[model samples]
Target: MPFSTLGLSEPLLKALADLKYSEPTAIQKKAIPVILSGKNLVAAAQTGTGKTASFVLPMLEKLNTERKLRGKRIRALVLTPTRELAVQVEQSIRDYGQYLNLSSMAMYGGTDIEPQRQKLIWGVDIVVATPGRLLDMAHQRALHFDELEVLVLDEADRMLDMGFIEDINKIIERLPLERQNLLFSATISDDVRALSKRTFSNATEISIGNNNASKPKIDQWLITVDKGNKSALLSHLIIEHQWQQALIFIETKHGAAKLVSQLEKRGISAESIHGGRTQAMREQVLNDFKAGKIKFLVATGIASRGLDIGELTRVVNYDLPDQVDDYIHRIGRTGRAGASGEAVSFVAKDNFRNLCAIESRLGHVIKRKEFEGFPVKKVVPLSILNYVPKNKR
Candidate 1:
């Protein structure tokens, strides 16, 4: 359905049209109306299913009316888990709310607090922030939530996984008790359900494209090779497949750097993004990747949640994620917004357990393919569904 049919104002529709968005995504179609109704919402959809707009569009429409500001008060507060995600959400707000008079900011650390403080002096209409940084402003009396009309927890499950529950509670405790609340998560795990139960009131719950509902539109496959032959195998696949672009996931910052160097040595230029780099560098890499200036991006899990490349066609696991859920987020970087994509993984015998956990969570075995010269020295067994995945965090 069109966004106009979902009760959004002309300005929002115009902005969306300018961005070439022809229709609402499934999450947008369901959540937008519920949000416009001013009711609490608990929405679940996988990454890249347009979850960001599901909340941002409706919230902007609801907060388009101007209100008198006092003591740095914001009308809507969006809490995200990572600094990158905070920046991403605020950009979407600006992109969609450009024709409106509303103001928005992406608040987070890795930058001077004074600048953020100054922006909060008059208050923005919408503030997308990380929980710790949000609390920092709260403690200094920089932002007032007394007048907050909407509270949105983007990637609520991720925030909880990062152990931001106390900060979330503290922030929620200060908001007006009778405001709209929305919780959005990629997966509705047991923890997410509990969070919704405790936080949302009389909310409409929605879940789409998860588990048995259907697997995402990604052609997932893996190649089993020796640890020493992994990089060579990747280079071979890139050349053989003639992939225009791919996002490769590594396990650590060192591993990320090493893989990029290896790719460069093979005459394929690549860049890496990880927590070890400064925020500016990471942002630049993300921009380059999106702009197609960089054909390949090697990232750690840090980029998995926040990196939104609309046309990213492939994501490769140079190293399989130890966390089972990360398998979902890493591959989700591709195959976004109902587009077909591919997810590739390089597995060594040592990664057998991790593979099992990931496959069990996926509820199916990823097809195995092999290169002619890259023979597996140690055979990797198929996934045994009952294997419990352990989070090394």
Candidate 2:
């Protein structure tokens, strides 16, 4: 169904048209009407399903038709887990609300607080922030939640995983008791469900796609290589494909930095981003990579959630994540917005168990293909034989 038939205001419909959004995604179609009806909602949707617009567009419409705040008080508060996500949501709000008089700003740590304080002082219609920094500002009397009309927890599962539950609770306590709440998560874990119970009363629930939906558009394949030659194989593949842009995921911050250095030594324009880097640096690296100034971006789990890079051609898993769901999120970086893309993973002998676990969770084995020159022998190493496949043994 088209977004125009969703009972949206004429201005919002016009804004969506200008953005060239011809159709409503499943999540958008299900959630928009419920949200517009002024009901609290718990939405489960995977990344790249246009979940951002499901909430942003409806919220913008509500704000446009409702009363405005009188002072420097925030009316809508969006809490995200990372600085990148906060900036991303704020930008969407600005884009959707451009036709209205609404104002928005993003605040997070790893930067000077003075400028953020100034932005709060000047007033904004919506504030997108990380919990820690927002709490600090609230405690210092630099911000107020008395006028809050809606509270949104974007990436709610990630917030719980990052141990931000206490911060989230504190922020909730500061807000008025009668405000509306919306929770959005890629996957609804037990912890997230419990949090939703406390945050929303009589909430409507919506799920966009299947729990194990396969992004058929993404061409997925695995390459088995020796642990020592993994980096060499990656460098060779990048050069061989002549890919203009690729986002590579590693398991650790240290690993990301080391890989970036290795790629740079081979004359590849690359940069690394992770939790250890300052927010400003992370933003710069992401911007540069998206703009094609850098050919490759190496990141850890930080880039796996709520980050949308348009038309990403390929995603490389340099090292497998411990959790099966993370593997799904890592490869989801590509094949976004109806664009066909590719995902390649390097699985070494030591990571065979992880590969098996991933296959079990996916309920199907991922096809393995060997590169012509970079062949891996079928025999299993004796020491790690127990972890290898029975057929290989």
> Which candidate gets the maximum lDDT versus the true structure?
1
Instruction: Give the runs in model 1 whose Cα sits over 4 Å from its true position.
Output: 1-38, 42-75, 79-113, 122-149, 153-179, 183-201, 205-215, 303-305, 386-393
TM-score of each: 0.67, 0.63
lDDT of candidate 1? 0.84
lDDT of 2: 0.81
Error of 1 at 328 (Å): 0.8
Q: How close is candidate 2 to the true structure, as a TM-score?
A: 0.63
lDDT of 2 by residue, 241-300 (tens): 787788898978999889989988998889998888777787788788888898898988
Which clashing pairs does model 2 show?
Answer: none
Worst 10 residues of 2 by lDDT: 378-387
* Candidate 1 Cα RMSD (Å): 7.4
